[model samples]
Target chain A: MTGFELPVALFLLANLAASLWRVLRGPGDANRLLAALLFGSTGVGILALLAFSQTPAATPLLDVALTLALLAAITAIAFAQRAWQRGTDPKRADD
Target chain B: MTSALAFDLLLAALLLLSAWQAMRTPHLGRALLAFVVFGLLMALAWARLDAPDIALAEAAVGAGLSGVLLFDAWRAIRNKPDSGKNAGDEA
Candidate 1:
């Protein structure tokens, strides 16, 4: 809508792509979870960017962001816990 | 016009670089550290983008809460025997 919003949109998209790459290329569940967390947080940031450009004065976006942030943590914990419970394979697949 | 865009772009690049490095690092311990840095820098980026309130929330949750969660997860997993073999394997 204004000069600032365009680049914000592009940055969010670029980071999202980057996070997706990590999600796919990750060697382990921890790596994938890391990417997933970053990916989700960036999405929340896009929402914040929307709030900033469109509302400009509202404070509710912070609430939304806080909620997303907590959820990301919960997801990370769940994934990492699964990784732990499943027992890591110290051996390569070829072996 | 171009300067602001350039600066913002730099911040975004910083965010991506730190995040990717964190995920790519072989040592899970180091990766957790990188995540903390990413959290802090991203919070600053929020301020650069003219969102102080978001910056505050980001710094608190992103940096503080996420950092703690990462370390807790790291502690939960690192002492286990298999992280050594888990580094580069596709899972």
Candidate 2:
């Protein structure tokens, strides 16, 4: 990897670190969930960078990134399903 | 070069800070968020260390799946009858 790659990676890492503030100081669960989404996106970025910095054999890493993106969305959906279940349905309660 | 080393050190320090936040946060929602953020940072660190496979896994399993689980739990709690005023207000 070139010297440039490391600095760029580090810069991304720093931003990830800054995002932790939302997680720690969350007044609500949604904030934490948002942080999780950020993690998925940033992780993909880091992985892509690492793969690119490596030999041409880094193709497998791209697959891994794709898997991550898919799973992240699924997870969000699953959580929403569970959270909005029958007993907990806010709309019902409001009615 | 020396600059690379500096970058690594800075990243490591930030990771540590985020990790601490994830573990120590008082509110459940906030704590979950912190942990997710921590996972993302960990993924970035892995990439920096030249392990793209690990970065991807961490991003998906650690951050994504775990985040969903946490949010599900939060929602369950938020909807509980015992949640009462807070739940009503928050909702």
Candidate 3:
């Protein structure tokens, strides 16, 4: 079991790197925000994998991941709304 | 020993990616986004190191909550004019 654990962990670790690359190299503003959302999802995956590798009980990490997802969604929406507000402001354009 | 070595390699790669991105990015919004991503990735690395509680805190508070805050800051920064004091502060 311990032997199998390391391999799974490594696989997830690699995925995190890929996601980080997306966040860094995303084409523009919207793409970067989208990539960041993907990054949060991967964080959830990493937590689930960690629980499997280290503990019999996965409830704690499951709870944490769920909370993070909810909060992240709300935050993203709020920022989107604010971003919309900026383009409409006339004074913000010249300076 | 092999497992530990693998862990070390993974950690090293994460550090390299994040450091390079942090150093080179000119945009505050992108840099802050990268920092949050780095924190989330590091939290998982901590879990791999056998630290569950730390991982929970890092994911929920360090990475997730902080990501929200920075995204909001980015909204404010990018939405403003050049003369706007809130624009373009580095992450």
Identify the candidate with maximal DockQ.
2
* Candidate 2 local lDDT, B10-87, one digit each (tens): 767777876776677444444555566666667656766767778778877776788777777777667677764554
If the candidates were sorted by their DockQ against the true structure, best first, what order would they fall in?
2, 3, 1
lDDT of 3 by residue, B7-87 (tens): 668777886788677667776666676676667666766666667678778777767677667767667666567845545
Candidate 1 residue A18 C-alpha distance from true site, Å: 22
Give me the candidate number with maximum lDDT. Answer: 3
The best-first sequence of candidates by lDDT reads: 3, 2, 1
Against the true structure, candidate 3 reaches a TM-score of 0.72
The residue ranges of model 3 lying beyond 4 angstroms of the native Cα positions read A1-3, A55-59, A83-95, B1-4, B82-91
Better of 1 and 3 by DockQ: 3
Error of 2 at A71 (Å): 3.2
Worst 10 residues of 2 chain A by lDDT: A86-95
Task: Tell me, by TM-score, which candidate is best.
Answer: 3
Mind giving the per-residue lDDT tens digits that candidate 2 earns over A30-78? 5444654675677677666656765464766777778777776676566
In model 1, pairs of residues that clash are none
Error of 1 at B30 (Å): 2.1
Return whichever of 2 and 3 wins on DockQ: 2
Query: Fnat of each prediction?
Result: 0.00, 0.67, 0.48
Interface RMSD of 1: 10.0
